[model samples]
Target: MNEIIRLQVALETDAEQIRNMMVEIERDETDRWYDNDERPFIPGYDSINMQKYHMWDKKYYKIMYDDILAGVLLISYTGREHARVDRFYIEPTFQNKGIGSKVITLIEGMYPMVRLWTLDTIQKSIRNHKFYEKNGYEKIGEDEDERYYCKTISEPIKEINRFNSDEDFSNQNFIQCNMQNVDIYDVNMRDSGFTNMNLESGIYQNSNLSNTRFTNVNMSNAVLGDSNMNKIEICHVSLADAYIHDTNLGFEEQKAPLIMERCELRSSRIVDSNLQDLSICNCNIEGMKIDGILVSDLINIYKSSLKTEINKM
Candidate 1:
């Protein structure tokens, strides 16, 4: 559809249409997602008096699509890179035409300085969860009746290419930033944090990463050499097509001869690896597979063959 979606600052004259539009939305959503008996719900657009009262200090916008009133949004912007969607809804007729998603993108574009956008949804509304999650809003937490969500906006520094080297950035907070292609070496990063970061194809040499926690990290096609990983704990991680090598002088040998000892592997999958002369003792072999065959099935077949040979004897 060739449509132009935009947001305009709502005026006092637009109160009646907004009230009627919200009524339409309330009627459509009644008994569908949330209970009608819910208390402390949004009553801003319920009537003209409430609408004007709530729109006093907030930036209320009338969502316009093709010069038509498609929806209404009440945003509470602090002008300091934080905003919240107090209330947002599309008219019943304008629902499910991809207008709601486009309007959200429009709001983000309108407030380029906003680094965090937060909103709340009815906790029981699974459909709404799918919609918001698909648009990059993560479900942060849930209360008695509502669920909170927020999306962090990352704006890359396009002008600067090289960060000054030999700098002490310890305890410095870097939030909502895109630091791709940044390089560093021989720095004190201890007692620092790297959350929601991307280190794909990154190089780390002669660095101290001891006592660091990496959760939900993807280190695919990467190398870990000449590091002290003794007594390190890993869980629920993917090591597909990966190699583990033991070396001397704390240096990884080119020829990987894995010698895993004192490891507790629970519910882990080892697929398509070389295990010649490997001994497995005191472990669970139930439902284990080898070469696309189950170990239990092979054992049963061997038992049946042995019984037949004894009867022939």
Candidate 2:
């Protein structure tokens, strides 16, 4: 799962690009960041007027998360000892993945000479206050509607891309990125870290796929050979259908879809799924529950009744 969060110099098309994406943001969240006068994120904001307003100079950037334009920032007076963050906003879909604080930290490295940084947010944004405070900014003053903040930097901070645990990761588009022969290992990237990742024609060996959602995707012509698919859900999609090979249905060319030997199947669940003509053999079935009844118990009761009938015969 590649999560590339980068800040690039604002381009000519960035304003319109970000505006085009604004329609995708949640309605309530859109209201939160765009309803007021000092909304901080102006859709019509452009680099030309940004430079004109910031004494004819500014450091503007567009926040890119993977292949999507997630947000933008405008820093005025970057050449001086003091700088101001004129505007900073992340799309609602891009927020809460922990991007804001990291953006603030990156700004520190962008301007090495700026000993002090300043910005203000709407007073209603308590999360913004806490976010700034968490990043070492202190509240200096506040008026009726705006809350001012400033942070001091003793030295230049180096920029690093961590995605801050809130990465716009998984199922992300990698446009024009050449990723050939990349080796990934020894990471805590489980569950949420790699959800909905595009593993098309990818190999996975000796991996534990816990809490993975394999629903509503096409996986036609996948050669499982009875690999015992557990917890995989597909909706209104029939297996082996030609249309199932597409994204909406999705798995094709099963290069060893699954092979299990001496495996543990304890506490595994299969629910609301088709198990027509399923078979099991040479496996442990102790305390195996089906519809809340133990398989062992059912077998024992059957055996007892059979013995009694044989004696009568």
Candidate 3:
């Protein structure tokens, strides 16, 4: 019988462990896919290449089962509109044990309206499609080769602005704080701990979130235009549907934490932040530090535009 396992998101500090897990999984899958009678033809090199890219771009979440690395799920974002599950694979030994389903459920519970892609040719893929369908995902489109398919998870809209005063809120604790639909215009939250707080659908225009902590905080559907987030320490913070424009995020002493996904910042100083799939547009970013980083299309366009302007001068 398969052992019951619990899942948790891996941290950036666990990079080496995650890499090793990826390697082992690749090797095992390669052996199975080639040796099995079905011969699915899944490329092991492709898995390795994708893992390397994810490590370089910092675009994956390590799925831990009972404190052990069981599998990996590659996450990608397209603008503020949606998040995509680019790749997901579990170990052969751990397959068909409801662990994958549990992980998907956890992700969907955390982030509603998430999207995922899968190939149609593989027989196992049909079961994958069924799994997603069982979990409230609906098919939206398919490609010609029957290889590419898209699905989305729809969820009910939750209330965004309901603060609870009964709960004790220490200066260093943001446990279960609801900042939804609340307008925090021009406030200073430096060095404060807002970890695990849900700030969905909130507006934080021209506010300072410098040196603040946001571990596992949910800021989905929030608008933070023209804000200051320099040196903020964030981790596992969901910034989906956030509108960030003209924000000042400069400084060396203050470094934002890792685990920032699906955030949109325009004309903002994003030095030394774990910026995977972050979309930026129409910004003056001369002398910016983006070395050895995988920037999104919007940021690339902004950089290209900046280069063009400089060349014209």
Candidate 4:
């Protein structure tokens, strides 16, 4: 007879139980799949360490069947507004059950936006793709190799104006607020501290964000078109998949920061942003800047083209 299972968000004390489940899952996954030289999937100590650290954040969930550890679901926050369903796995013995779908439903009810990624190359896991589609996620886009399918969760809350216009938000400590899809046009946001906030898919046109401080914020998939971001201090911010066209980022200085890693910066004009000190690894920067300067070994673009354009000035 199949036994009923219980699902709960893991607490810090459940670390030991979760760790053991992770080990079992890794062993089972590795044994079933053969490792390729190019993309080998090795179960290592580092992966366990990551699980331990990530579980402490209270974002992970552990599934138990008949009071025994079954599997784990890893949830990572893209900020406060968006959460990514990083890893969802059930033991081979527990496959074909409704555990995965139940967990996804729980996540969708709690978070505004949840996303998960799967590979199309995994023919064996084609049922997994169908499972997600059955659970209300849509295939938004895909990467090269026809693998890495991005699936988005249900729709976000739609309000004409979610941000308070009359409130004196300047010099306030804001944390983990959702400003997605809000029309924040032509506003002056200065000397504000926004940490771990989600500004995804939000429009910030003709807005002024001078001397604003942003740390650990997710600006991914955000539209910063035609915004003025002068002298802003942005550190450890994720600009992944952000659309930044015709924006003025001049005179901005980012220090020892994680700026624009794994992002696309198409048609964005960045000038005099002391980006020389920042790391521009894994970013696609296009278009021209009048005084664009580069100074880090991390950026290995066409130096002659950049220099020639600079020399002409």
TM per model?
A: 0.48, 0.42, 0.40, 0.44
Model 2 residue runs over 4 Å out of place are 22-30, 33-58, 156-313
Residue 55 of model 4 has an lDDT of 60
Question: Model 3 segments beyond 4 Å from truth?
Answer: 1-13, 31-59, 113-126, 140-146, 158-313
Candidate 3 lDDT score relative to the true structure? 0.54
lDDT digits (tens) for residues 1-313 of candidate 1:
7988889888888888888888777767775655558533554447776566545554788889899999888886643456778778888788788987897898888877677788888877787888899999998999978899999888853343444656666667777897665544335655445566666655453346666666766666655543554434565566655545332323345433445544555446664345666777666777687777988899899999999999999
Give the per-residue lDDT digits (tens) of candidate 3, residues 183-211: 32213467676555765555554467777
* Ten residues in sequence with the least summed lDDT for candidate 1: 243-252
TM-score of 1: 0.48
- Candidate 4: residue 78 Cα off by (Å): 2.9
Name the runs in model 4 displaced over 4 angstroms: 1-3, 35-48, 79-81, 112-124, 144-146, 149-313
* Candidate 3 positional error at 24, Å: 3.6
Number of the top lDDT candidate: 1
* Stronger candidate by lDDT (1 vs 3): 1
Residues 1-313, candidate 2: write the lDDT tens digits. 2577888876554545655554444344446655654344443343333323322233667788886778778776522456678778788778887778778778777767677788888777788888989989999999977899988786534552222334455655445454333332222334532223333433332234445545443344322211223344434444332211101112345422223346555667665444454566788998788889998899899999999999999
CA lDDT, candidate 1, residue 120: 89
lDDT of each: 0.70, 0.58, 0.54, 0.54
